[model samples]
Target: MVKHGISLVEAARRLGVSQSTLYIALQKGQIPTFRRDGRTVVSSGALRDYQTGKRPPCAYRL
Candidate 1:
């Protein structure tokens, strides 16, 4: 599996949600993310934090 990070599309795929829904959530600032190499990259760290109960509730359920 990809370990370092993932693109928004791939992240959505991994989360079993539609890519467009992920995009909409991102635009609404409802997901945790960051930028890398000029591309918006979802933070693996934040995903972990979310999994471990360290983040606010988000509706995506990813």
Candidate 2:
């Protein structure tokens, strides 16, 4: 169980990927994200929603 609103790095960690990999996916739009105070972020709610089929699966390969 993860808390809501975590950093991109932590999101990558939870998904078992390197920060660089996540960044690459982000750059390619293979992953979802939002800006917060000018910082890249991945909300846990989004992740959870994704897991529950709320969002499409990422084409990113780690």
Candidate lDDT (C-alpha), each = 0.70, 0.70
For residues 10-55, what per-residue lDDT tens digits would candidate 2 score against the true structure?
A: 8888878888877776665555787777777887766676456566
TM-score: model 1 vs. ground truth: 0.62
Task: Compute each candidate's TM-score over C-alphas.
Answer: 0.62, 0.59
Q: All candidates: CA RMSD in angstroms?
A: 5.7, 5.4
lDDT of 1 by residue, 1-62 (tens): 44456888888877678999877766655667876778888876765564465765665533
Model 2, global lDDT: 0.70
- Candidate 2: segments with Cα more than 4 A from true spot: 1-4, 48-62
- How much is 54 displaced in model 2, in angstroms? 7.7
